[model samples]
Target: MTEHVLYGGKGGVGKTTMAAATGLASAKRGERTLVVSTDPAHSLSDSFELALDGEPSAVRENLFAVEIDPESRADRYQSIVSAIASDLRAVGISLSEDEVERLFGSGIPAGGDEAAALDVLAEYVDSGDWGRIVFDTAPTGHTLRLLELPDVLDAALETTDSVRGQLHRMATSTRSMLMGPAAYFGREGGEDELAELKARMERAREVLRDPERTAFRAVLIPERMAIAETERLVERLHEVEMPVETLVVNKVLEDVDEGCSRCRTRRDQHRKRLAEIHETFPAFEIVTVPDETGEVHGVESLERIAERLEL
Candidate 1:
């Protein structure tokens, strides 16, 4: 079975770094790993020092990376919706071109990006290609929405299918009465398409909630606001039954010079916040990553972070 690891938290909390490092670590352990950036604002390529696209590309031996473009995914999702509308029209449902345009003219619906990301994620999970897959998710709010979307979308799809069936039956009855005899235009293709999407969403939800196969790691800085946000995130995760077991406290001031009072004071504040983090999430295994000398980019830096991650 393939294992999944997702790193998520507030924006600029080094989630991409943690995810990249974890991928490197997994690959070093001889597992074929793919690091995926599901964030709309992708920084995985910058972190890896290589250009990436929707398709997975080789990063190093046993390691591959990809960045899911939200815009492209959203466009694809819109196309799928348009296909369903076309199918309805083919089945004798009265949908004017103007009405269809009105319904889908808007670029992307609310949560469309997340829904598309979920679809892409399900495809990757079903592929059974990588030994392990690590995800660098979006910020806390967007990541939470992504995790919650499967259920919301499933319900919406169910409702849509039911309504479509009812409308089809009504259309068939009316046409038969008017024309004396009318052939049934069954929409098996559209139904199958919807069914497949529902199944994919359900599978993704299962993978997310399964602890043995999936791990949700929250990454944050040693700050009060970040800690509070993480606490809320963990609570929501627990509510959704996708509990987080690991917390990464990144960019902690590790070694303050004795002579520098300013550095020492900042380190002291970090310690206080660290203690609070432990108190708040006592069950979580917290990993502290010290502030590096410079920007954390490139494979070499990621390797160092991987060591700190102890993956």
Candidate 2:
């Protein structure tokens, strides 16, 4: 079974940084790890300072990363819908090209890439090659919708039960005419499409909810916004019954003992919150990663992150 580690929180709270560090930790343990970014504004590549926009690249011996292509995903989705439209026409249900495209595009964001990327993700997990996978999801709202998509879709399917059954029968018969009935239902069709999507979402959620299989590591700085976001995230995940596992305090002031005004004030703020984080949430464990001397970029800098995490 593959493990999924999700890093999530409000935007710009070091969620991606924590995700990259987690992957590095797993890789150093000699486990094969694949880290993916589901954010439309992907910065996993930028954090590592490596090129990964369209395909997976071997960042290290056991580490791989990919930033999927949204345009390609949308194009492939269009093709699937076009074929579906043609099949509907054969059954005397005339569907316009624009209408078909609109149907596929409906409910999804303006960009089809996330859905496309999700399509690929379902396949990768099925492949069962990697030991671990880390997903750097988009900010809170978008990520929640993605998590809830399957339930929404299943409800829709139930509401359109008769139409779906007819569509499936029509699709099966059309495929039966050529290359036997096997290929058509197996490839792309109404019932199969619905089942595949439902299964995929549930699988991701299973891993997401499993504490051992996946962990949602929320990152927070000492500032007001980051701390406030962390509190909200904690409550939200609890409502979903998938409470966060770890809290990472990134960019802490180094050398609290040093006699410096800026460091002293920042250190004081962090110390206060650290106490609150521990006392308020006794079940949760917190990890503090101090602000390093310089920027954290590239493998060496990221390695320091693993060091902080003690992996």
Candidate 3:
């Protein structure tokens, strides 16, 4: 059984750290794990202290990582559209050059970084190649948009298909007039490709919505802006019935440099904000990662953070 864990929060928060930590923890438990960064501004490669590409690379025992390049994935997406056009051409009436350009223009019709990332994600989820997949998602807004992508894509595809159906009728009639009754025109593989694409989308939707297989972990710091963003994110997730069961309160000032007045003030502020978090999201299981002396990166630091999570 494949289990997916996604960490999402406001930008500049510790989502990448938490995601890396969680991936380490899951791998420590002997699960084959892959930590993938879906953020267009990816930091997973830095976190792992290993150069990574769009393809997964081994980071440690049982652990792998990938930082998706949205542009590269968008190119792959465009290729799929082009392939579909080729498949259409195989049977009979080929689309006009303008039609081909329109279909493949700008990649997905309702496309953006999030859509590109989700297309990569959908591929991974459909593959079922890893036991555990941990996602370091984009900021709150982009992550939410990615989660909502399937519905948007479904609607867009439906509209496109309807238009194509009408065009198909028109094109077939034209071919009949030109080639007579025994014309060699058919939909050929176009419908099959469309069905395959739809199936892939539906499969991605199932994997994301399955609570038993998918979990969302929100990472935030004890700051006003982070708290506000997280609250809004939770509300949006509730609206969509996407499950977010945990809150990781990262960068909590614990055992800070006592002599520093700034540290002291921030620590005090953290405590109060933490109280608000407890009050605001009472249902969430709260976990804490205390502020480290230096930046947390690389496998060792991520492992330490994972230990702090006490998972």
Candidate 4:
């Protein structure tokens, strides 16, 4: 099975750095790796100091990176909906464009934009080219919302059948267009947009549920607030049946670096936190990243962190 690793946590806790380092680790092991960013704020590029866009851009010898945004996919989705509404309006249909959008948009039972973005990521996964994919995801709240979308969507669909059936039918046709011999989306034939949406949702559900192949790991600082949040995330994942497999403690101070008394005191606090992490989640692996004074960017810097991760 193809392994996928998704790194997430608090906004400023260095999750992207960990994700990128892991990608570097994969590449060093000769794995064809692609690290993509699904964070709307889009910091993967800045983390690696590499240029990125929707299409995957090569970051290192074997790693490629892309920063996907909901706005981009939402725009494409919007245009499709607009054209669809216009066609309906031309036929003297009573439905307005906003109504048409709400009809589909409201039914997007999950995190509206995140589910759409995952659809994009799933396409890349299905390409059967890369050995691994590392996802530098958004912060906890947004990531939770996105990951939980499939279940929300599934429940909503179960509750409302009358409106969902047409879209389901459309999904069948669109997938057939994309995956079938009769596919001609831009030419003599076209796909059912509703069908496309269904296929996308199904893929997200599968990805979110499959723990053996996908790992949702959290990165944290050795602070009380960070540990508490991560612990809560673990419990939330358990409640939702989405498993979190690893916890990483970043920027750990190795020893009391000669600084002000405050720095030494904080270092002592980290020592205690490490012990707490060991006690709290004994089954899970804990990886430490040293506090580096120099900025961590580029493949060289990532490689150093990868070594610490033993990745």
Candidate 5:
């Protein structure tokens, strides 16, 4: 079974940096690792200082990376819908070309960006090409929605039961002449495709909730707003029974000069927040990454931070 590590938090809290580092660490341990960005902004490539596209590209001996492009994913989703439309047309459903195109262009069933990103994630996990996969996710709200999407999808599929009934009525209306009987129940029709999609979505949901197969790492800075947001997120996840195994307190200030009053004040504030963090997340294993002097772009700097991940 493949192991998945997902790094998620509020935006600008170093999630991409931590994800890249963790992937690098896993690769160094001889695991074939792929670090993927689900954020529409796509910063994983910049973190490695390497060019990447929709598909995974080798970044090191055992590391690969991809920046999932939303446009590309939308196009792929459209194609799938188009195929479904064709199947419907063969069964004599009077759907115009524009109708099919309109359906394709509409947003994905549940929370467009997160749903599409999770679909891609499910594909990667099913492929089994990597021993470990690290996801650099979107901001907290979007990532949480992605985690909660399985329930939404289950409900959506249930709503589609009416559509399936309509399709069956259409089949009987046409006497099933052009469309084979096998098309009514199997892969030749839309029903089986929707069922397969649901199965894949459920599989991804299981992988995310399984502690042994997956780890959700929440990253945050030592600041009031970040801490508050993280606390809320942890509570929400707890309500859903989704486990967060680690809390990464990123960009923590270390060794501030007492002569510099500004640095000392900021350090003191960080200490208070840090104490609150320890109290708030007593069950979580906390990891801290000190604020670096320079920008942490490129593989060497990322690897340095990855060393601190202790994975």
Candidate 6:
């Protein structure tokens, strides 16, 4: 059974770095690990110091990385819809040219990137090709939308299937009088495809809600706004039944010089926020990463961060 780990938080909170470190740690432990970035503004490549694509590329002995390109995914999704429309036309259900233009000409739908990312994520989870998979999700709002998409899409698909079924029945009933028996068409192929898609979504939702198979880790800084947003994110995750049990507090000032008053004041503020984090999320296992002196990038820096992760 492959384990899935996801790191999500406010943007610029170091979710990508934390996710990369965890992937490195898992690979170091001899697991075949894949680190996936769902952020449109991908930084996983920067963190790993390696170029990546939609297809998984090897980072080292047991580590792989991929960045989901939302624009490309959205284009692919539009192509799929066009194919479905053609299929409908082949079955004697001709869509008006106006309808086709309206559906395809307007470009990617709102939130299409997130929807496409969810589809790809579900496929990866279902593949079970790696021992461990880690996700560097988008900012809190987008991540929440992605998590909720399975249920929303499932419902929409169900309704669409029902309407299609009704149209099929009506067409079948009227075919004899309108275009004769030669015009009759069964929607078996489309129905089968829809059923399979729904099943895939259900499996994805199950995997996400299973704590043993999936771990949702929320990352945050010590700032008041970040903490508040994190609280809301956790609450929403719980509502969706994908509860987060771990919180990663990144960039803690562990060694502020006593001579610098400004540094001391900032450190004191961090300490106060740290105490509040503990008090607020007492049930969560908190992991703190110290503020590094220089930019954290490349495999070596990720390894150092991994050591502090304690994952």
Q: Write the per-residue lDDT of candidate 2 for residues 1-311, one digit (tens) a residue.
A: 23777777788767777778878888999889888888888888877898886777888889998876666555444444555565577567887656765765643434354455556667678888888888887888766665555455456545544565577677677768865846464444455555565676566556556676667777777676777777887887877767477888888775765667776888888888777777766787788888876666788788878777642
> By lDDT, is 3 or 6 better?
6
Off by over 4 Å in 4: 75-93, 98-110, 156-161, 164-191, 258-260
**Model 5 accuracy (lDDT, Cα):** 0.82
The TM-score measured for candidate 5 stands at 0.88
Error of 5 at 206 (Å): 0.8
- Which predicted model would earn the best TM-score? 1
Candidate 3 backbone collisions, by pair: none
Worst 10 residues of 4 by lDDT: 182-191
Model 6 TM-score, 2 decimals: 0.90
User: Candidate 6 lDDT, tens digit per residue, 84-164?
Assistant: 575566447788868976765533545665776766767887787888999999999899988898898788778767766
Instruction: List per-prediction Cα lDDT, in the order shown.
Output: 0.85, 0.71, 0.80, 0.75, 0.82, 0.83
Ranking of models by TM-score = 1, 6, 3, 5, 2, 4
Better-scoring candidate (TM-score), 1 or 5: 1
Off by over 4 Å in 1: 74-80, 83-98, 105-108, 178-182, 185-188
For residue 226, what is the lDDT in candidate 5? 97
Displacement of residue 307 (Cα, Å) in model 5 is 1.8
lDDT of 5 by residue, 1-311 (tens): 23998898999999999999999999999999999898988888889999999899999999999987666656434544655565577466668877865765543443777777777778988998989999999998888898988878878766665566565666555655556574355434455666677787788888888888888889999998999999898887776667686999999998888899999998888889999999988988899999888768998898778888965
> Which window of ten consecutive residues has the lowest lDDT sum in model 2?
106-115
RMSD (CA, Å), each prediction: 2.4, 4.6, 3.2, 6.7, 3.3, 2.7
User: What is the number of backbone collisions in each predicted candidate, taken in the order shown?
Assistant: 0, 0, 0, 3, 0, 0
Query: Where in model 3 is the C-alpha error above 4 Å?
Result: 79-104, 184-189, 257-261
lDDT of 3 at 33: 90
Q: What residue pairs clash in candidate 1, if any at all?
A: none
Q: Which candidate tops lDDT?
A: 1
